[model samples]
Structures are given as C-alpha cells and as structure tokens.
Target: MEGMAITRTDMLSVADTVAREKSIDREHVLEAMEQAIQKAGRSKYGHEHDIRATIDRRTGEISLARYIEVVDEIENEVTQMTLGEALSEKPDAKVGDFIVDELPPIEFGRIAAQTAKQVIVQKVREAERERQYEEFKDRVGEIVNGVVKRVEFGNVTLDLGRAEAVLRRDEIIPREHFKRGDRVRAYIYDVRREQRGPQIFLSRTHPQFMAKLFAQEVPEIYDGVIEIKKVARDPGSRAKIGVISQDSSIDPVGACVGMRGSRVQAVVTELQGEKIDIIPWSPEDATFTVNALAPAEVSKIVMDEESGKMEVVVPDDQLSLAIGRRGQNVRLASILTGWDIDIMTEEEESQKRQAEFNERSERFMEALDVDDVIARLLVTEGFTSVEEVGYVPVDELASIEGFDESVAEELRARARTFLETEAERLDTRRKELGVEDALAGLAGLTPAMLVALGEAEVKSIDDFADLAADELTDKEDGILKSFPIGEQEASDLIMDARVAAGWFSQEELDAMRAEAAAAAEAEAAEAAAEAAAAEGAEEA
Candidate 1:
C-alpha cells in the first residue's frame, strides 16, 4: 500500500475537476473528502483516529496527518510515544508538541467513491430545491406572458418563462378555446409548493382581467380621464360596464367605444364575440338609471330611495325591448346600476295613472285638511290644521312659522266648512261609482277551496284577487306551483273570476254541458244516417 503510485497532486486536481463539474465550491468538496476520510480512518482503527486535515483553498489540495504526542515514555497506544522513538522521525521533539505520522498509503477504493458520489448527489438536490423555492416565492400577483402548452378537460397548462402555470376550468371564460403554442397573458394569482414542483395558478375569468384589458385598450382609463365605476359580467354572454369621466370634455362611453367601435370590438373579439354594454356613469342615480336602461327609451323613473328601487316606465313598443327576452336587459341594468328596477309598459303606466287620478279625486272630495305629512308635523308643533292655527291663536301659529293666530282661525274655519261640504260630495260620488255595492258583492262568501284565504280576511274579490302570483305565493305557500299558471292566467283568475263560489252558476254550467253533449249526439247521429244512405245507394 505504501508503494502505490497515487500522489496528493493527483487527488487535488481531481477534486477541482469534480467541484467545477458539479457547480460546487472547491473548499466544500475538500471538506467533504476530509470528512469521508476521517470516517474511514475511524472504521479501520479500533479507537478514534488522531487525524488532522488541511486544505489549500485556492489549489484545492487536501492533506491528512495522523498525530501523536511526544512523551518521555509511551503510555497510551494512540496518543503517547517514547521520546527516543518520536525523535527518530524528528530530531527535535518535545513532550507536548504534535508529531506527524504518515498513514500507510490507502488509495480511495470503490466504497469511498460511492460514498462521495452519494453526498454530492444529495447536496445538489437540496441546492436545487432551495434555488427553485427562492425563484418562485417572489412571483405572486404578477402578469406572466406564456405559451399555451396543452389543454386537458378544459384546463390549460401554460409554459411560463421559468415554470408552468395552470388555468383552472372555471377560470376560463365560457366557449373560449386555446390552441397549443398560442401566446397569452395571464394573471398569476398564487404560487404554491407541491410534490411535483411549484404550482402556479392563473386566471382569465377574474374581474381584474377585464379592468386590465380596459386599461390596456383605453388610454383614458389608464390616464384617469375615465374611470370604470362598476362592471357586471355574465362571462362570455355579455358584460355591462359603468364608466365615468373626470373631465367634462371626455365622453366616457365614446372613449371606451373608440372611433367606429374599434376599441370595444377589439375587446369583444378577444372574448370571442362576447357582447359588452358601455354606459356612461352618472352620480345622480336617476340619471345613471336612465342611461343604464339604454337602447330603449324610458318614459319615467320613480325612485324609492329607501329601498334602492326605481320603477321605470317605457313605451309599449319599448317595454319588451327594455325588459329584453326573459328580462335580461333590465336585470343587467339593475346589476350595473345597483338598484332594483321594475319595468312597466306605457299601457300599464296609463292604468296606474288612472288609478292615481281616482285616488286624487277621492282625496280632493275629502280634502278638509292639509297634507297628511304636513298634518302630522302640525300636530307635533301644537296645531292640527291651517284653520285651527290660522284663526284661533295667531301667536301659537306664528310659533311654527309663516302663520299668525288670525291665519290659524281662518284655516280652522275653512277646514271645518270644507269637511262638511266634501263629505256630502264624496257620498254622492261613492253612490255614483257604486263602490259600496261592488264591495258588498264579496260578503258572506264561504267556499271550502278558499277557506285558507277566507281565514286571512280575504272578503273582497278585489282583495286577494288583485294580488300578483308572487304576493299570493307569500301569503299561501306553493300556490304558484299548485296553480301552474302564468302571471296573466293567475291575474285573470284572481281579478276576473272573483271567487270560486261565484265563478259560475252551477245550473248554467250544467245546462251548457248538457247542450254540448246533445250537440255531439246530434252530429254523431247525422253521420250514421249519412253512412246508411250511402250503403243503401251502393247496394241498389
């Protein structure tokens, strides 16, 4: 073993070659070798090896020495040596100084090579994992340009610059298709470590994607000249967007639409023919609402601010168009405008107008008082009406503002006088309209089928009878399904039929059924007689 041809120079050069090839530091390789050799030495020797390892950092030279302490006499087998024996190798030896003892030449065998290779491979794997972890951990929420690698079950695999990302099935817009090797941009939503590798999640259906698309296409949006106020999408079918402009000079709608519909068409083509509605945003909810119901003219908008509701009236010709097929237009407009919208045709509006006219007419007939709200406020202010505050005590009326005692007394007298005359007039009108007789027709109605309704005090045919199917559904659960009728049919049954008991006279219904049977019998008998005549003629 001592006569082996291996030299330290050869090992040093070989260490440098291994370190460079594996992209590891030369000193690290040397340290690994020293550890391996120390382990081997301890295995070969029964006791721990008195080994010292040294390396030249630049040259990658590693040298190992077995050492013993020089002593007057050898006391331990591993550490101590007789001074005369130590001085034989070294002429000047001290009692405590280390003495170098070269080990027998033991060339690194196949076992050592295998051990070094295992360590190198393990270190490289850990390094690679660390490198990949550092690389992707900082890439969240970014837009990555990638190529579509493949599509499986509607999910897409994209080849990002340094890794791969998955676009989930639902993240893809409906009816959109991508071919392999197509270039695309995606929003990097998440980056997570997984068993296979780093998993990156990308999305195209996200609302932010639309905002980014607008930012890219419309310079006004990017420059803050126009702002996208709200967006509601039925992904791939249609999208409604509300836009506003900070500068009065810019029309937000036209800016989004571009000249001759270029900008919107670009976005639409990218969405594969998805329709988009670009409506100008208004701070005034009423004005915004009117714009939201675009492509159809609206007659009026009555807003109920407390409920965030707006009842819109459109011409009869435009009602269907405004409501769209299945009410999609108004529904989208509601979503876009953040209001619950109710649409009515011009005819329905006219009926409502007439109803309101009748109510006003009745109020006019009974107008012996101020408005209800004003009356309530007056009572709170220690006055009941204009006449009471106007005529009786001017000081008391003046306390409330704009009314003196004389004015209060005059108002009180006027109210009293108006009450008497108005009551008479109302009575006359009620008789003329026959409203009392009409209500009386609903009296003493007891039908078993309508027992639940009767228990709820549905005395008038016009009471429960004027209710919509949905209202009836709330009062009596599952009635809509049981009835299985359209809104018009239900309306007709409630309004036209009045009550089941009074729907038709039983005797009249029986007579009609009997007449129908008789007519059917007469027609059958005529047919039989004609057949017999034909048979007789043929036999003759």
Candidate 2:
C-alpha cells in the first residue's frame, strides 16, 4: 500500500509552473491545491469528519489529518473528543488541544481528480484576477497601448498583454474605428475588481487623454517644467489645455505647441485631427480666461468674481470667431477656465451699457422726482436704486459731481417719500391678502414678499417657518415669485419667523440667534481675510 502511494512532487512542479505562468505567488497555488485535496479527503472519509491537508513545501509530501478538539464532554463525536479519549492519544492533552489522527494519503479517483482540477483552475483564475487588479489599480490615469482582441457592438476589448481592458463605445473618439488585432492606445481611467475578473476601463475621449498625449510629445511637460493646469475636450472636435511654466524663460504655451506645432500636431493626429488650444495659465482668472479664448481678440472682460462669471467683449468681426460655430469655442473656454463665460461684441456691450444707463436714469427720475439731468448725474454717480439714495450718508450724496448739500437733501427727501409711499401701498395689499402681522414683522420679509407668501397660502408665521429656503427663494417659481434673495437672508427670515411662531423657547431662540450671529461673524471674517489676501496678491 505504501509503495503504491503517489508522491506529490509532480503536484509541486505543477503549482510552480502555474504560479510562474499566471504571475501569482507560488504559496497561493500550493494553498489552492491543499484546499482541493482537503475537499477530496473529506469526500473519501466521511463528510461529518474534520479533514485537513498540508503539503510539505520542500518535499511536496502531502499530509492528511483528521483533527478532533479535546473537551470535558463531547457534543460532536466527529470533531470533539472527551478528555479521557484525547488523553489516551496524548498523556497531557488539554481541553483546547486538537487531537490529530494522521491518515493515509488520498488516492485520486476519476471524479475526485476532475473536481480537484476544477477547484485548482477556479482558484488560479481568481489569483490571476487579483494580481491583475493590484498591478493595474495604481496604473490608472496612465496611457496604455494594446492590441484589439475583439470589437463587439462598437466596444473594443483590448488585450493588454497580461490583462484585458474594455474601451466602451462612448469612451471612443468620435468616428474612430478599430478591428481585431489593430493596435490601440487609450488612457486607463478606471480599474475595478469584479467577481468575474478585474475590469480595466479605457477611454480615448477623456480630457486627460489629450493631456497625456501632450505629456508624451512635450519633454517640458513630462519633466515638470511645464505643468498642465486644466484640460477641456469636445471629443474629436477640439480641445483646450491650460499650462503654466515654472521657468520664466520658457514659454508654457510655446513649449506645449513645440517647434512648428509638431508636438501638438502629434497629439492632434492621434485624436483624429482634433484641434488643440495651448493657453498660458494665470492665477488671475480674468487673464486665464482671456488666454483660453485665443485667436479671437478680447477688447474687454467684465468679471463678477462672486458669481464666477465673466462677460467677454470682442470686436464685432471677432464675435462669431470668439463664439465659434455652435458656440463650441466659448463653451470649451468656459470649461477650461471653470467660469461661466458670456461672450458679447463691443457694439453689443456699448448698447447694453447705454440701455442700463437709460434704465437707471429713468428709475431715479421716477423715484426721486428729479429732472433728466439730475437723474443722469445720480445714475452716473453709481446710484441705481432710490433705496441707496435714501439710506446713504447725506454727505456721500452731496459729494456727487454735480450735487450740493441742499440738492442732496431734497433728493434724499423725495427718495424717502417714494419708499414710504410704496411701503404703505404694499402693506395695505399685504393686509388685504390676509398676511399675519407677525409674519410681516420678521426681518427680511418685505411687505411685497409677505403678500406673495400670503397668496401662496403661507399667511401665518407657522406657514412661513415650515417653508424651505428654496421654497421662498427659488428663481423659477417660489412664494416670493421672481424676487431673488440670498440663502443667508432666507435662513435668517425663516429663523425669525420660527421664533415669532413660538416654535422655540425664548432662551432657545436667543441661543440660536447667537449661533447664527457667530456664524455670520466667522463668514465675514473669512471674506475679509480672502479680500486682504487678494489685495496683497494684487499689490505684489
């Protein structure tokens, strides 16, 4: 029987070969083989018995054993043994010791051999997948070249030597086609380990793909002399890259463009003739945005820093060029700069300015009962609203180019009268609309806003407190109609309404108010700090 026993030297050699071929650890292969053998051992013995197998690494000798746990009393006869029975095998057997019964080597049957082979194959495949995932997980965002294994429904599966990657249809460049055995290069955007295997996702249309191509073509970018700040792509149509140079002597845009545009042309050729814009980056958003809209000269840029928006003015002839066909140029610029860009012609800007002037002048004339010349002066002095004229320091109003103290006084008086009359009219309407007086008393809730809330069935302080900030301030449709209020203002109003409705105790409301005041102070301090930093940067 011992002479007929099989030696596992061949098994060890097979594990080594499989580990080498699959690029997995030799121990993983051996452990998988041990599990397979242990399963077979259990089947040959009894399913109720506790069977385990271990392979000697040096000799490839497999040892099969049945383990029984020593206990004071045996509950499971198959796995647990009484101390008396355990001590019969070993004199000093303890309660926790496992009594091992060495068993003869398993003889492989036809069905058992096939089952072991299946388990080994399954485990090796899993180990291969894990190895693939570990190898490629850190390699994401890198450009990889592979041969197309298959093309199924416009999706290409690339054979990446050891692993496979899927280039989805939407991730492929527009109109780009590949067939079996064709070489393809793509950016590894994602790598996910799934039950079947590691799924490597490739993309040719990602904005980073364009950036990586430039990094390959341009030595400066690869070596970090020129850093890519941002990238925006419209697939194969066009792309924009924002780059900044560390060395003052080197031109970032020129470095990326290369000699005679060779570097950019190489990238463009790979992208199926996609146009590339290499713009010099600036810390100043206005300068960066202007640079992003290259070739189309910008006459002026009016930026609203708070809104992250810029109104770019170009010459009338350059308007179409700045906007591009179907607004692709400006759209790409917006994406590149991370700002909302509104492009307008110089003529259009002038007309808009004139229209704003007329509107302000007319507002002042009506609100202050002033003549056209006085209204124009007030508008030119940056007073757009009667509220500003009414509440501003009298000395500030008098300091306007054409206004004296008496004129300022009279203008302010008229502005005050207009506001008082308007407020009285709105208050009367609010009363008629059945708005509660307590709701009107809430700060930031104007008579008009209260009337609008009343019309929306939010007539009480309770109703007002129950409304969300957006429910009152949403631009499209809200209780306040087209009235635009900031989130902080809405929050403050809601808290005041809640307090007025006796939703919280006075002490609780005071604590809440204190918290809000502290938040406001912190926010104001943050804003001031940012403003000072920006001013310092500007000065520097």
Candidate 3:
C-alpha cells in the first residue's frame, strides 16, 4: 500500500518523464495532470460542483478547490454567488472576485489512475504532433534523407528520424522504384498539419531537388559565388540548369560539372541516368536562350518581347539537335528561359522570306500601279507596306542602292495616293455602317476595324466598353470576326474605350481604394480597443 501511494514529487517526476519522452513542454504535462485531478475531484464530489485544480510549478504542490465567482446577483448556486455571500467568507471580497473553497486530496483507485494516464498520454501525443508541425513547417524546401518505412500503392513512406513524410507516387521520378528499407532522398515541398497528423509531402522529381543536389556537390554554388538562376527538368530523362557566376574568375558550369564530370555524374546516378545540360546564364535573353539549347548551334534569333516568344533559326543539320528527341531540348530551354520558342532551319526561313517578299511585291504593284520590276525593287528595299513608303522620309527611300531621288519621290507620291484612296473607301464604308467618330479615334483600330465594329453593332463607346477584351481580339472568334489583333492591343483599345465612356479614372479609383483602406484600419482599431477593454474587465 505504501508503494502504491503516489506522492506530489512523484507526480512532478512523472510529468518530467512524460515531457522528455514525448518531446513536449513540461508545463503542458503538468496542466494535463491538473485537469485529470479536477476531473477526479468532480467525480468524488457532486457532479454539478465547479471543481478546479492547480499544480505549483516550483514546489509541485497540488491544490483542489470549488470556485464561485462573486457577482451582483446569485445566478447558479454551484458556480456563482452574490457579493454579500462572498464578503461573508472574505471580509474584503468584491464583485467579480473568485471565492474558493479548498477540498481534501483525492486517493486514486484503479479506474481513476487509468483515466489520468489516458488523459496524460492523449495530451502528450497532441503536443508532440504540434511540435512536429512547428518544427517541419518552416523546413519546407530542404533536402531530407530517410529510410523507406513502407510502400503502399506506389507511394513511399519515409521515416525521417523524428518525423515521417510521404513521397507521393506522382512526385516520384517516373519508372523509379522504391521498396521498404531502401534509403531515399527527396525535397520537402510541402508540410500541412492535418486532422490526423502533420503531412510532410516530399518529391524527388521536383526541379528544386536537382538544384539542391547540385548545391550539395558544388561548393561554389553552396558558398554563393555561383548562383543557380533556373532549373527545368523532364524528370528521369533530361534537365537544364541555368547558372551564373558572380565572380568573373569562377566558371559556374565548370564548378557544377566537377572533375571529369564526377559531380554531375553523382547527381545523374541518383536521378536514374538523367542527362543534364549546364548552361551559362546571361541577362541577355537571346544569349541565354542560345546557351540553353546547347550542342545545337543557333544562326539567328528573332525575339518578340511583347509576345514572350523567340524564333530560333538554326542550320538544317542542327535542326534535329535543337528540337531534340520529342522536342525535349527546346521544351526545357523554353521553361528555363520563360519564352515560347519556335525552331526553324535556315532553308525554311529563306522560303518564308521569299514568300513574304512576293506578297509585298504584288501589293505594291497593285496599289501603286507600278511595273513588276519596280515593285520588286521596292520590296527588295525592305518596304513591306505602303504606309511605310508614305511615312518614311524621301531621303531614306532614296538611300536604297538602286533608287534615285526622282524614283523615291514618285514612289512616295504613289504611296500617299493609294493610302488616301484606301482611307476614303474605308471611311465611306464606316459612315455607311454608322461607326462612332470616338471609336474611330482610338489607336490600333484601323478604319476597317471600325467598320467591322459598326457592322457588329459596337458603334458607341459604351458598347465597346461593354465588350470583353477577348471578344474584341481573340483570333478564332472575335467581334472583329476575321481580323486578328494582339492581346495587348486589345487591352489598350478596351481601356481607351472605357475611358472614353466616362468610367472612373485611374486617380479616382486610387482615391477610392485609399478611402476604403482608411475605413478598414479604423474598424480594426475599434475592434482591438474593444478586445483590450473586455480583457481588462475579465481581469478585474
């Protein structure tokens, strides 16, 4: 019986043991013990009694009592008492003060002891889970090594010493197999605390995983002398890494490749023989893109900044290498460079140029009433449109190798006549369709575009404003129907139409947003003040 009696010191020792074993706070364990004691006290006393327990942190003293709050009026006899009754017990008792009645210690029986143990175990488990969540939540994006604990339905569960993580099937490299007890290295991409436990999701196929592997092998990269600008991978097959050296003396690519390719080979072996292309990054987009499609020579690159696309012209023999097996090289390059790439051989480019030249020549001959030879000469001079010929200074046109001042003047006069005739024709058609003058004044909208809008019943500025940008410029189906326009032009035109329609100006919208922000700040201040007042009253 003496051995079975649990002393107050034993209670604190047990809490310390549980806290140490579960990796939870000792105070949390003590609080759980206090709750268990209060439950037992309530069971021994009347179930309706408001019993509470507190453990002294320094001395491990257990105190049990029934607490009644002193109020202006008695509400429930079990938990609340009038100020008069509270004053009888304590002469200086006031409203809002607690009146406590001490209770005797509880002797735990078999069932009571089991209940307390269960409560402590539950609380310790909850605290452990919280600790795990907090520990790993910020550790996301770190590389972790673990033993494969189990494999279920293609998903691998890794036991990472203190925590367990899941490597989902899709996140695993394609065709890569893992079995129980096998070691695995993965990147912690996400950590979510769910109802059951913390879900630490890991991935080996993520691009960052390869980046981390390189960082591990390359001391220069790890030391911040070399920066990994971007990484793109077709997991288990091929990858492209863009690196830039901050120090001119260090070669970022050489550092990552290591001696005799040992460093990159180590990464490749881990990735199941995936081929890696190390590209020297450049701030110049064209140079960077050319380097990204390595082992394939690029003859010329035409970039369209607004469209986020690049046209790469390679020699006919190098076309296959540039495109890669199933377009993998260019695909990875596009991902690394953030540009859509269109590959073409020199022959194809020449053919396209000739076709464009013929088209321009025919248009010049028809519009300017010139002979085929003269039109071809104009086309060869890089004049693609009549508008360019009309707008360019006569001296610039005369600078063309075969042209004189007289010929340049004749071409300019003919271009102006053709443009004026075309404008008159389009203006007559626009008037026939009742196109609004304001719509005609908007930039990027041709006279023909205005007629198309009028024909589609979008004549008024309000009507144009009501139309979506896609409806105005989408290639396949738009209000312009067959006329193609870029998305940026469409957006600009739509905004212009909106402004013309007397919608809110940019400055007005900014002022309104500022006003709303001020109101929200005031409301939050009021809420904080109220919360502080409520806390003060509770303390009183």
Candidate 4:
C-alpha cells in the first residue's frame, strides 16, 4: 500500500466518486480526509503534539504541521509556549498566535489507511442522514410505498429506496402481517431526527391512511371536486369516512363507492378487507350523525350542545345494528361526527321520558301541596320547575283545562310560598356551611348553587375563586353537579368571585375577558370549520 502511488488527481477523483455515491458534498468528504490525515500525523509524531492538516481545494495537495499556541504562561512544553519564546520564532507573534512547523508528508500505512476509511464512512453516513432528514421532513402526511427490509419482533423496517422507515407494531393494522421483501403502503405520520438517524414512522392504522388511499383511487377526491371531511377507523375491521362535494351534482358517496363498489373494494382489499362506510358529510351535527350511522335508521335525536353530546333514538330492532359488534359501529360514528353519542331504542327512550314525567309530577305535588291529579295535569302542560310554576302568568295557568282563574291564583299562591320556604332553607344551609355572602350574591349563582358549594366545603370567596369549572360541572365529582349550570356559566361565576375577592380589578378582569373572548372567537371559528369538517368518546 505504501508503494502504490496515490496521485493528487486520483485522490480528488475518488472524493468526487464517494460524494456522488453517498449523495453528500465533496467538500465534506475532503474535510473528513483532512481530519483523518491530521490524526495519522499525530500518531506518527508524539501523541502530545498538536497536529493539523489541510488539503488544497484545487490541487488536492496535503499539508501537515505542528502548531504551538503563544500564551502568557506556558502550560504544556510541546503544544503551548510563552510570548517570549514565540517572539524568538516570529517577531510580531502575539499571545494568542499559533506558531506552525511544517512536517514531512505522511505516506499511508496499513493502519492509517484503514483509519481514514472509517472516518470517511462515518462522516458520509452523517451527511446522508442529514440529507434524508431534509428531504423527507416535508413529505410527512403522504402515502409512501416501500419494501419490507426486516422484521424485529412485531415491528417492520421498510426500505424506502432513498431512506428507511419503521412500521411500529401499534401502528400496524390489527392482525396484519409483513415479512421480508413484502410490498407495503402506509401513511408517513411522523419523521424525527433521532440519534441513530432520521426516523420515519409509517402507519397502516392511521385514519388518514384510508383517506390517502381514497385520494389515490378516487379521481374526484384527487381533483378536489370532492373532499374528505373526517375519518374514523377500527383498523382491519371497519371504518367510516365523511366526505362532501363542492359540486352539488357530483354525489360524494357514489364517487367514493365508484361503479358497483369497485373503488371502495380496492381500498378494502388493500386494508385487508376492512369494511368502509362512506358517510355524506353535512354542516349540521344531527344530519352528519345520522349519516355516519348508516344501515341503522334513527327515529329521533336530542343534542346537548354545551356538553358536545347527542342521544340517538332508534327502533328497538335496529339497536343491535346501530351499536354494532362490541359497540364498534356507534363508536366509529361518535368519532366521525365528533360527538359523544348515546344510542337507545324507542322503548327505552319512552321509558326514560315517562320516568322524567313522573319525577316532575312528584316535584309539583310536593311543592304545590296538590294531589296527584292536579300535579300530573300541570306536568302534562310542560311545567317542569317550581320557579316556572311560581312565576308563570296567571292567565297562562288559568288557560289549562279544568283550571279557572280561582284555581290558578290558589296554585300560584302555594307555589310562591313553597319557593320562599325552600330559598330560606337553602340560604340557612349555605350560612351553616360558612359560605360568604359575597359568594352567594355573585351573578349566575342561585341560593341552591351556594348551598351545593357550601356543602362541598367551598366556603369562602377565595375558595370559589380558586375553583375550576369542572369542580362545579363535572358529572361524577362536582359541587353543583345536579344543577343545570354549564361549564362556561360556571367559569364566568368563578371569574366574578375572583373579582369580588380582590384578585384583580374589574378593569383588569375585563381586559382578561376581552383577550379570552378574542381567543374563544378564533377557536370557535376553527371549531365551526371543523364541525363543518368533526372527536367524541375516543378518537380512532
């Protein structure tokens, strides 16, 4: 190897070849060669000598030198020297100047040549990693085709031609399999620069994987005539996708299903026979929810907008189909429409309504000192609360069948007296629990709410101010859980309590509210677009 003359031209040509082969810059390879040469020079001389090497960019001529730093005081005898000693070597030498000494060029020996090869390989690999990172970073969210390179445990590594990717075990479709050399298509969900290299994570179970598949199969989706609004999947089993069309004449579902189900069949085949339900998307939540639960007809729907939940009523026979095997069908619908859904049969819903009616009837009977007949009549007329009974127009109450002005006046008198007694009892209970008058008097807080808070030991304005909305509105563990208060109303009451507790001036609170309102407005706009676009219980 020493006798084999490596010409400067050959050295430069080899650098270019390696750079092209590794898809790295030639200059980077040359810098790596210079470092290897420098290391070899240090090895040839004393290890303590400070050696550095440089290569002529045009000529590829290698130069080696020993550098001694000029310092105020010498530290190491070989690498550093005093200013006086450096000045003897060069008249204008400064404290920080390096005094260089040229050395005879190194001829590559076996060990040195092997060391140089290792250095070049490592640097080229790093450059390749950086290049792959830069190239693939923007390609996330795209479907990529790859060949299985290896399988370790359940995870599969894919050779993506220019780079490699991993299909994590959890990200694979349930029961799917891949072996060495198997072709695969997956969504590039994440790409990260890891210590080993740039890691590209692919997923066959991602909801978007199905969307991308549709884009590949459906020309309308690819052309933007139809758009996919949302996707929900039980991978390797079933899926639902919400699609809408800008062109009203072009049916979104038919376009996705294609002629005789050919298009969807292709996607199903690729997904290992996972079933698909192409839901026609709508801006209305109730409409979209109905469409998402296809093959199961809905009789009626009741939505609670504040809680982002809906109750779907279906025929008794359709319950099994609506909820699916292991509740997968309703679960996917909930995920697609972005609403927590409760599915109940017609008979079940009727029983619920009758139970509520009986409860209200009992409440009226106890509050108004009326018999079951009068209370049942009042409940049937849509009177739900004692407050409504106490404050409704006497003429309206009189207009009910079998009730005249005299009966209406007597009923109103009893209702008002009962409310007065209940309010006094709640106020007494609140005071017994040490609830502050300031907290009791806050807007949006009724006497009943105060009693609930006081019972929960939130006794002071500070306690009220420190409370979160969920502390009052969460279903299972809330102070006023039984109250009709929503999270936003609870949040406002807490802020009011904070202002009363001198946590901040009203002006500061107003400013904070204004900022919050602006943010809420922006977020609501995004939510509206997405609602017009739809997460419920658990996102698949």
Clashes of each: 16, 0, 0, 0
Q: Residue 456: error of model 4 in Å? A: 8.7
**Per-residue lDDT over 1-540 for candidate 2, one digit per residue giving the tens place of the 0 to 100 score:** 222445678878998999999999999999999998898899989889999999999999999999999988878988998989888899999999999999988888877887788899999988889999999999999999999999999999999999999999999998899999999999999999887899999999999998898889999887777889999999989888999987899999888888898888899999999988888889999899889998899989998765466999999999989999899999999999998899999889999999999999998888887789999988888887888999899999999887899988998899999999999999998899898887888777777777788788888889888988888766577666456576667877887777788888768978978998999999999999986886577456
Could you tell me how far off, in angstroms, the CA of residue 303 lies in candidate 1 after the best superposition?
3.6
Please give the lDDT score at residue 88 for candidate 1.
85
Model 4, residue pairs in steric clash: none
Off by over 4 Å in 4: 1-7, 45-50, 68-97, 368-540
**Which candidate gets the maximum TM-score versus the true structure?**
2
Top candidate on lDDT is 4
Stretches of candidate 1 exceeding 4 Å from the true structure: 1-143, 189-198, 304-308, 349-540
Work out the TM-score per prediction.
0.47, 0.81, 0.77, 0.78
- Looking at model 1, residue 469 earns an lDDT score of 60
Full ranking by TM-score:
2, 4, 3, 1
Instruction: Tell me how far candidate 1 lies from the true structure as C-alpha RMSD in angstroms.
Output: 27.6
lDDT of 3 by residue, 1-540 (tens): 221535779889989998988788999899899888788778879778899989888888888999989999777888998988888899999998998999887778777777777887777778888999999999998999999999999999999988899999999999899988999999999999899889999999999999999989998877777889999999999999999998899988999999999999999999999999999999999999999989999999988886677999999999999999999999999999999899999999899878989999999999989999989988887787899998899899899887889988998999999999999999999988888888888777899788888888888888888888788766566877565566757876776677778896867656765898899999999999986886577456
Model 3 lDDT at residue 509: 54
lDDT of 1 by residue, 1-540 (tens): 232423667657866786776555666666666666555555455345587656566654556678888877666868778878788888888788788866653455666556645665555444444455567678765567899999998899998755678999898888778889998787777778776666788887665666667878999887767888888776677777899987899999999999999999988876667788998888998898888888889989888775466899998899888997678889889988888899998789789866765554444234535555444445556543333533555565555665566656655666667756655665555445433334434433223224435444544556655566665444246344333344544554554434434656556656766898899999999999986886577456
Q: Model 4 over residues 94-203: C-alpha lDDT tens digits?
A: 99999999998788888888887788788888989999999899999999999999999999999999999999999998888899999999999999999999999999
